[model samples]
Target: MKNYWYRFKHYPFYQHKWFRISLASLLLSVFFFLITISNVYTETYSIERFTEAKETIRSPLSIENEKETERERRAAIQSVEDRYEISTEITQERVGYVNELFEAIDKIDEEENDSGQSGDDGNTVSDKEKAQDLQQMISPEISDALQREDLIQLITASPNHRSLGKELLTTSLYDVMNDGVTTENMQTGIDNIKEKLQYSSLDASLKEVLYLISEFAVVENSFYDAEKTVEAQKHASSNVEPVMIRAGEIIVTEGQTITNEIYEELKLVGLLSDDRNVYPLVGLILLILLIGAMISYEMNNYAAKRELDAGKIASIILISVLMVAVMKVTSLFTGSVNQLFFIVPAATGAMLLKILLDERLALVLSMMYAILASLIFNSEIPGSLNMEAGIFILFSQLAGIAFLVNLKDRMAILKAGIGITLVHILTVLLFLFLSFEKYSMADVFTYMGFGAVAAFLSTVLTIGLLPFFETGLGILSDTKLLTLSNPNHPLLRKILIEAPGTYHHSVMVANLSESACEAIGANGLLARVAAYYHDLGKTEKAHYFIENQMGITNPHDMLQPEQSAGIIINHPYAGGKLLKKHKLPKEIIHITEQHHGTSLLKYFYFKAKEQNKYVKEADYRYPGPLPKTQEGAIVCICDSVEAAVRSLKEPTKEKIAEIVSSIINDKLMDGQLNDSPLTFKELEKIRQAVCEALNGIFHSRIQYPTNQEVKEAN
Candidate 1:
């Protein structure tokens, strides 16, 4: 029975029955809530007191003539026919042109074939027969020149081959030098043609003929059928004309009656979809799925990675579910309230999510929340669903949450809340402008005011609910940490008085860590608070550390090195105990326990080594499991960097930068930074922030003389 119970309890699927039930319940609730809200908003929007519908909302094209339908039908058919006729004409013209060029090609091919067959025994031919053959022969260049329809058309009326003649001469001159196209071949072809037709007959009038022959030779050597086809296609396509079809009104004269066939065609084309409805259902579904996935993934990752208590998980999930329910309720009031009233539902959910969860998940879930809110208020499928409105709200609310990332104080969150409000309003305003739809300025202003109110309420809800989750859920938000760990807070003040030196050192480390976190967009306030409470164990043995000792002789100098190492190494656990005794948050206790990690007190270990020569390195290290929370991890870095910088007799910015970088690198190499959210780019930013803070802390101050010294100088 014990073995079965253990296996069942440890199984992941069975361990969190409450979570599974809650998630399923939440999904069902959202579906029903949306349905209920949709009905309510529809009813309220229809009420005259909420929104006064104009008595007549005439179609924009009502002024057009009634016979417009018949006239448009005839015009469209005629336009298509004309286009077809024009396209056919261009195609026929191309085919005819290509046929003429092919005829010239056949004439040249027939002459070449006849000459090849007439050759006798490979040797004997009469000069007269040769001359007749040469005279009858079409120059290969001329044949090719005629085949190029573009060039042929250019000289079809009166052939001019001056350009071709010049180009051929230039090409042949280079070829002759390279011994490629020999002068002898050129001379033989020329002489044969000249003997048949006298040299004097080859006048400038015949210059076109000479160049044409040369062009044929060049083209026949290089021309492919594909090239001619492409040329023909270009010719055919260039002559085709665009056909235009008029849009808008299809009515004719006012007295004319509409035909059933025309009306049915228009209806089919959606110029008149008076019946079927197409809701923006896909967008709404996508929004829901995306939001649900983000929330689920974030919640799971947080629970698993942080090893949060079951109670904390329940609290976080409870708050998330409650926020969704609140949003549904608020959406119901959208009609009585301004259009901007819907933003309250969106911003409130976003702020709560951001506070309870991390920014990436919050932003993603907020978009889903926005989509759900849209579906609630605008459920009508065909003409009523405001898809643009939903999208605008989603994007603006997402931007708002993104802008609030890593904020250090409540005021900052409040300020960001206002900014988020403005973004939501502006999004709506832009939508209105682009829509070009008629809406009233009074309504717009009313919605803007509603948006402001919504933003304020969102901030209020977030602030009020934060502490419940922080304490009951054992969750620590940036705002909660910043508020509780303030310098003037009662508990912090007590720590300062009880251990003044440790308190001062903590404050300095907080400054270092907070700025570092901010530079890198990590949780700055969390880091700062963690840094403050990291040394709470020192309160128990304040006199032992050098900072609390002042100029007094070191207590460790008298004590054995092993005893001293134990005292120093044990402070982290002691601090954790002290924090727990005071009922401080678990995260704070973790900060105390993990700040030192398992790092060794090397000085004490070496001191023991020299004295007894029998000490193990393990005896000098702190009893640690290292930092688990982002805050704890950040505190560890800040603590080491601050102490190392301060210990330097005269630390400059350059030296501090190097030392800070080296310490962080060592921690990274030791795998201390693995679980933290900080990426490499963020670490570099933290390094810069640390360097800046260190420079300020270690700034050189002028020494003032004592009375005795002043008297001696005088």
Candidate 2:
């Protein structure tokens, strides 16, 4: 019954790809739906124009009142009086006409005098003829108004009288026309001429005549400028912007009458019943689908390449959900009074993923988290997206990921956190300075504090949750490797105390394997840690191994070659069991078991061949399974190379290179590397790395002469 229950619980359906994707999609969709559901429903309120507001209504989003703003702008422009230009040509032409009329009258008087008309009848005839000539020379309106007697008297008067009258009338017309007389102000121009003549020395009759002539001369010099008026209006309109109702601003107070303007503002801000729009909801869903599709495509590709598994996928989704939830919860306190969105721990997910998974996956998740943050922390604008928050989150997450690229220990997360904090501070300051007119000193400081808190909280939370993810997911993170590589670890300590020579040999193998594995793009820390525990089974029977025998009598010489072969073959399986019993990670156990692979035990096989004329070569080989990963294969190669080179006396660079190449070539020919994913190029790189490391370890040192010998020679 227990076995049946276990089988039922571990059904195959749960492990299917479709089922996992559906589950992940459901989780993400639910999270996105919950955070953005408020924008979907249309909020209704009972109100009408001219009615008092029941309560204060704040704008949920910002909007522009374009029509009302334009009306106000036009009103401002119309308030300015129209401008007119004075025509100097009008004054000059009118003055010149007056001078010509006076000159013509003087010429006519000179003609009469030259004819010698001194009789009264002759003077009468000359005056009448002069009147007719005056009528012809001057404007008809001015000439017809003048009496025939006045014309004759002015024509017969002295030239001084005629000059004075002409001068006074010309001066009056010039003054009136120069002052810019428009059609509406023509009467005022006539009155100004009368006032000037009243203060002059001219007789009343002359003043009247001059005023009449000046009024006609004063044409509307300044006309209405239609183009200038239109231009001024356009400039005013261009300068005026739409009145914006900002998000969270109060649109109306309680008991205040909802006038037409107030109602329009409410509608603009989306507070009215008809203002509820589904575009934000549609936009949000599209954004979610886009982000989800990108993440799905990347994950699917990664899984196809065998870079990620079900466990890792589950961990990635779990971390993503947790990070998004943190952002959503943090957004609760964000508002106009306090823009606390900066306090969201955006870097936590990227840092955790980088530590638990590969850096590429971590960077992808950082972008996803940034998008989620933009939507989740949009409390200030409620239904709208906060691009500023998105930018801040993106840079902060990127900073954390970059700083954690070379993470060697758990403490590096704190340093990464510091870097993320500094990046956040800079980003916040940059955005603030960009909109310096909008933010106050208090707001800037508050946002800075939020950034600092976010950095600190992200680091603290990552440190707290890292162990759970590492243990629960069975992930072999670098921190876990560092932990297992400690000298105090039980397995390592046992090997150190029981088999000191084997322990030292494992250390040298670790150094070589780590460098070679890193050169081939494998996990170097895992290789080093696995090398430390690969020979752990030798501790159970220490002195039986030549390394631990320490110059003692050889026990292997008395044993049959088959028996020695069996003992040698059993160590890999025994070490795997020991590691498993101590609850070590499966990767380490796999490396321990696959290190020797199915290769033949050369010494024991050769000894057996000499002892017996016929012996099965297969019987002297280690149990099946070969190295299945690059790190495992590198450890296998380094293990043999270390032991073989240690036995050489006075090893040179050429000998070390030859031995390393020969061992790698033998392993390749023997098909020990068939299961590993290492390519031929990577293998060549590993060979070079191993040769260089061996040369460093076994290079000859320069010999020095003793002081006593030098003194004796002297």
Candidate 3:
């Protein structure tokens, strides 16, 4: 507990909250800066209006081309014909003018007849004078339109001819004017009236007079209706669809003249200017910041369980940089058609992280990598996400994490690769089937090939890179621990052959230690593997230890108390040295050295105290430095409990529990567990786990009577 407090309080950078925040911030900044390059990166174009395009350019964003939409709307409005309301009132009024001409001519004739007593000249009125009088009495439009000769002919004609001419003119005028006429067809209305009058059986002079009256009477009835015209135009414009520039739509082809329309389309999708990158960059930064926050949470959790050092932080950063770099490189060759990103081996980061760090962290990082892949592989389209690529990358990495269940050997990575490959193909197929486009069998084979390559590369890369991390970072992965746990390993085999009793004891300690470690959420595999090699020093003087004394006496029996304690105390250090010589991981070596701690050799010390009443307690104890980790602390407790329980006359559950509790308490009181971060709660849990495991190993068995006793009974 004191060690825990000292480290928590004294460690300057790694343990401080600001350190994690700053580290996460730095990582976030790097991610934003790198990803924003893709947001801004593209082939620079020197676009100008009405110039030939150098190459084909596709729309990066799916958006409405508002300018083109407005233009098309204008065209649609222009296409609507002007609306005209045919006024029935104007038609009736024009027909009234034609009838009034005939009535006025008759009224003038009657007036001349009624006033026929005598003219001012005193002779009977001549036909010319009568015609002039009739002309004066009629409307000026008809009087001025007809010549004096035509008026004279009309007056001289018989009453029947005059009536017939009036009928022909009125009927022709009504027929021509009834349907309504615009200024465009007004001449046609006039010509039709003349044709009807000329065909009639009337005097030529009288017909000319009637034709002149019809021309003055005819007027356009079809007036332009401004309000109704606007309504029609509006309806036409509304029915026109908005012009849209779909994403990946080819805007301009190579050597094609960049018309004003095409240039406007290029600008609509934001390909014309660099100033448009700000929004996409801001959005990218926000997303990356979120991913960074999640990573910080996972990192803090790791730190809470284990020490967070520069090496682990660097490892994460390095792997992330490598993953992004690979994506950027692969994306350079990818486009909407080729989709080369499918073969980027993106799951390699996930597998590496899972093998080297926490699986939850690996899973979380996988999601982030997939998101980044979407950005990187977006087919050069700014502000667009390749959802298909993103989804495939996500499932591909998830499959890798799911299938990497067994980390016993490198073959596990290969198996995970196979799983990732199948998932990638399925994901690609899902996208294909969901798409509206028709893809041929060739597309299927091509995309499936991409998935297959991705899997194979991931498997080979993971297998290849595992060694570098193991050797360089000194990371003690579960795979390495399993490898060390094999009895066929040289050191383990040496212990089994040279000192079988010690091997048996180690195997029992392993079972107990593994259970205890797991109960406390510590590294169970490390504890189990460490237990196997903890007594490696006993092989040097196998007969000196009690466990190795199968058929022979312990050499320690003839030795002094100080000598026996010295031999026992030297074993932890000796085993630590042996492990180091084999270039084992530092964690296993540390556990081997720390298992015994500086606990007092009670049996040897008590025996020495009886011989010398003033024996030094320090000399009887193992060398200083107690178990400084939870796994080592657990192994220390279980090692003693296992030996003590085995020495029981008949090991029972209650006795095993008692022995386990006693050993834990002894270690606590003796300060052997003080340095480790194990709490009272964790210790209690370890005790129960150790007791259960021991009970299983030492459970009661059925007994049978001897043959001699059976014979006696018979």
Best by lDDT: 3
TM-scores vs. true structure, each candidate: 0.55, 0.75, 0.79
- Against the reference, the lDDT scores of all candidates come to 0.60, 0.81, 0.82
lDDT tens string, model 3, 1-714? 565567678897676655864686577558656754664444446689888888889777678878878889999999999898888888777777667766766776777776765564545768778778777777776677777787777777778999998888778877877767889989999999899788889988787777777777888888899999999999999998988888778889999999988877776666776434466667776787787777788888777777555556667787788788888888778876888888888788888888888888888888888887777777667777777778888888888899999886647887888889889888888888998999999999899999999999988888887777777877777777878888899999989998898899999999999999889888898899989998888887778888888788778789999999888888888888888999888887888888888988999999999999999999988885688789888888888987899789999888888888888998999889887889999999998898889888888999899999999999
Q: Give the residue spans of candidate 3 off by over 4 A.
A: 1-5, 8-32, 41-86, 95-210, 220-277, 307-311, 409-411, 517-522, 551-562, 608-630, 668-685, 704-714
Count of backbone clashes for each model?
20, 0, 0
Residue 202, model 1: lDDT of: 32
Ranked candidates (TM-score, high to low): 3, 2, 1
Per-residue alpha-carbon lDDT of model 2 for 206-272, expressed as tens digits? 6665666666567788867888877877787678877788776888999999999889887766667
- Residue 37 C-alpha lDDT in model 3: 62
Report the error of model 1 at residue 162, Å: 84
Candidate 1's C-alpha runs over 4 A off are 1-291, 294-320, 330-344, 379-384, 388-392, 395-406, 412-453, 551-553, 610-614, 629-631, 652-688, 701-714
Model 3 per-residue lDDT at 373: 78
Q: What value of lDDT does candidate 1 attain over all alpha carbons? A: 0.60
Sort every candidate by lDDT, greatest first.
3, 2, 1
